[model samples]
Target: MLSWRRSTSATAPGSSLAYGCADFLGGPGARKAHVLRTVMVAAPAGLAVELLLWPVLGASFSGAPLGWGAASGAASAAAFALLHRTLAIGPMNVLSPVTALVSAALPVGVALLHGEHLGAAGLVGLPLALVAVVQVGAGHGAGVARPSRTALLLAFGAGTAIALQLIFLHQAPSDSGVAPLITGRAVSSAVTLAAAGQMHRRLGAERPAYAMSAAASVLDSLANLLFLLAARNGDLTVVAVITALYPAGAVLLARGVLAERVHRGRLIGLGTAAVAVSLLALT
Candidate 1:
């Protein structure tokens, strides 16, 4: 059984935490001040972090890495857009699980096809983890709309883009360091800004929570960095599945900081997640 691979320095768990914090900080602001407007701040904020780290990390902007970075950037931007649109059309509880499933399942399938195996512990833990991700996102409010075909389509699209972003970032060469992220973040920032400009009227006087957006972006950047490192050192299937449990982190954070009520389903999810992580650690 794959209990969190100690060999990877718990990078997957670190990624999950960072991702959860990013979502927690970003989610409210996006919902309140238009997703695109919040993203305008988030994207640039991430770019600034990457720019600062690029030189220290020893960036080498080669063709393949740059291409992958750009692709990842475009995919991330698409994911943000599609995710918000899908949520607007449907409930988060109804649509989020689908997106989360696709994002994890696709990468797991690809990793398996490429000859990565999870062994016994991983086999036991992975399913539980995936289930935990869905359960953790279960809601007491919002997500009241019945999921229609359009919402399903958008959810699937967003998930696909999210998967692609991860895959693209992982595909960058080892020596590429954080250079690819710099390129990727810059591209996403430019695209987000342009979209925000086009939809400025939608923003009206609803200014984004700049500090929260920037904090979220920094957390997201850290998560991506950790994910890339974990993917490089561990089986993609294991790392991706583990990292996808990020929703649990967000839920707990909301409960603690915002005093949001946790549903019974999510409490069970947290319990299951603890079990899953314990099992995966043996791997």
Candidate 2:
């Protein structure tokens, strides 16, 4: 059910025709619609795939790890809603990386609290990650409006939910496999997506809106699969860090195809994030 294909914008062959067509037919609104559809489709599909992969943990379905994951996802969605309204920041540019950073840090901190000795490499990655986060945040400030106090707290709450979700994923029985974990993700995502649909209805849905959500949903599903696989098989901290780099993907796509100009600082921060990804993965 993966509809997303890898296509480059600048250097890829057969770009001129598509670019001309999009320029002729798909304007800014078309792009916005694309983004919205991507969200709706990818978010739900991603969750479903994750749940399908993770075996349910605990006896009762609601008592399983998926349940808690669903809860965490709901919390995250709420946080997103708050941000969309109050902060006016877009999802990929601001929300995705921020959540990824918090999710990565949380598990590491939790592991330490549980008396797990982090490798020296992990210890080193921590401060570098912190610096990377600050840089990303500073970069985001250029295009997006500053979050108000309420929006900031709510956004933090979203990050907390994601962090807790990862922590719980790590805490879940290893034998639980992919079914339960992916199920949890699916449930959470379903709730969030349904809510988003409602919000869109209220906000007014247009052609571009539908397309963007559809695209996001597809991307989200793919990301979800990658993250779930990474989490189940790899170190949670490392997995979280790598997945957090998704924003860079979005930014690059925007710049390349959409021709959206990024602030230099944001570009630098994203570059810093890329370095952090390399360092975290190696460690």
Candidate 3:
């Protein structure tokens, strides 16, 4: 919970935590079931959260917001399908950094084109942010098969789609409220359910991750909500960079909950991320 004026200071970290927790659960859930089937749980759960938030936030029917929401839904659907597919089949060491780096870069590029500058502290923080993401991503899931041409394309596409989802949500008018989120989640859910229905036989045979998926979906939706607020209240470049630090959170969660060792690179990344955030916030 953050006031609109203070949200920029708080929401980015809040969003990062939500995203981290979501990925933590979503990763294991995907391993248990088909990733798309896990999305079946996420779709409805996320949609329900948006619907609940809609009334509290207030919304209006507007063509621009609605169109942007639908576009975001499509991008989100593509990202969820592609990124996980790539990770499932390709080398995590190479492709994960590709996705993470591209996603962080695209939003900052857009923000620059829109004349939003990160200023002096941000200049230093920006490169650190990029380095942090690389370290965070590269430290995990090592030594799978090298990425194929198809996997490379999918990783890049997933990154672009993720960036587009954030940009589209950022484009929604402030007065439009959470309607865009509701519309986007509803569209994505319907698409995911249709895909899951087709794989019902396969999904049925696999272990279900109902509770885990639901919790992840809820947290992911909340993260998006917090991100939208932060973007609205602050420079897009700043918020996007901070939000991309989510992998650091995931790594930390893994250390605490799963008793996994935090590799040196990820530990450095997490520490770097903390310093970058402090500098970005202060100046």
Candidate 4:
């Protein structure tokens, strides 16, 4: 079970969802070692995929995106390591709160920096993005607690990577192709796994944790791929904001599978986030 400083996230709704999925898939048990292995291999694969896709997408190919991608990737890897170490320190609700918020707003900052005018849609989504974040916090508060300093720092670092990714995506040359982006996903997955391996050894995780971590890496890559596709097809603001609902997906998974407690706050938070999404998109 993934422990936090103050919270036990093993039974967290999000955790439950993942556990249930593994059980449903009937592939393996949800042990720490398994989670770790899953994370180690799958995470970097996602990044590698993104890197390869950028060139094919016809976007202005530049090393700048890769540079920033590396930084963000490192930050994310650090975050995962921290999560493993501080599993017993904080609540899943607490740890996951601001990540999406940071991610959702990052693209807007990138667009503005690049002098892309914010449309009405952009204006609408901004506030909803905040609301959505609040919902995540409320929903996960039940068994959550304050994280260790290391966890907090890692969380911030992860947020930074996510934000940087959005900026890079926004700044990617208009003519950029999707090939490199996909390639990046695969490469990054490998990188993440290596980092996870180092951390696994440090933490001495068991088999189940390794598997879960591996699964997380793969899923995270798929999520990134979806985000890229969404960006390719939809407005940045819309795509970013909608995908920010990922934590909600994680939370929902917990409710159905882990038999974890779902707080009313989560319902309200999700509802608020939904309202924000609708308002943001419509505007």
TM-score head-to-head 2 vs 3, winner: 3
| Candidate structures ordered by lDDT, highest first | 1, 3, 4, 2
lDDT of each: 0.83, 0.50, 0.83, 0.52
lDDT of 1 by residue, 166-283 (tens): 8888888877888778888888888889988988887767777899889999999999888887877888887887888888889889889989889888899899988988778777
TM-score ranking, high to low: 3, 1, 4, 2
What TM-score should be assigned to candidate 2? 0.66
Please, what is the TM-score per model? 0.92, 0.66, 0.94, 0.67
lDDT of 3 by residue, 170-264 (tens): 89887677877888887788888888888787765676478888999999999999998888888888888888888877888899999999877
Query: What overall lDDT, based on C-alpha atoms, would model 2 receive against the true structure?
Result: 0.50
User: Which residue pairs clash in candidate 3?
Assistant: none
Provide C-alpha RMSD values for all models, in order: 3.7, 8.3, 2.0, 9.2
* Highest TM-score scorer: 3
* C-alpha lDDT of candidate 4 relative to the true structure: 0.52
Task: Kindly give the stretch of ten consecutive residues in candidate 4 with the minimal lDDT sum.
Answer: 1-10
Model 2 lDDT tens row, 126-236 = 566655654554444543644455555556666676566556555554444454445555565677666667667553454454444444444444444344445555566
> Which residue runs does candidate 3 get wrong by more than 4 Å?
1-4, 140-145, 201-204
What would the per-residue lDDT of candidate 4 be over residues 54-130, giving only the tens digit for each residue? 44444444676555444544444454555444444555455556555666677656655655554676576567666
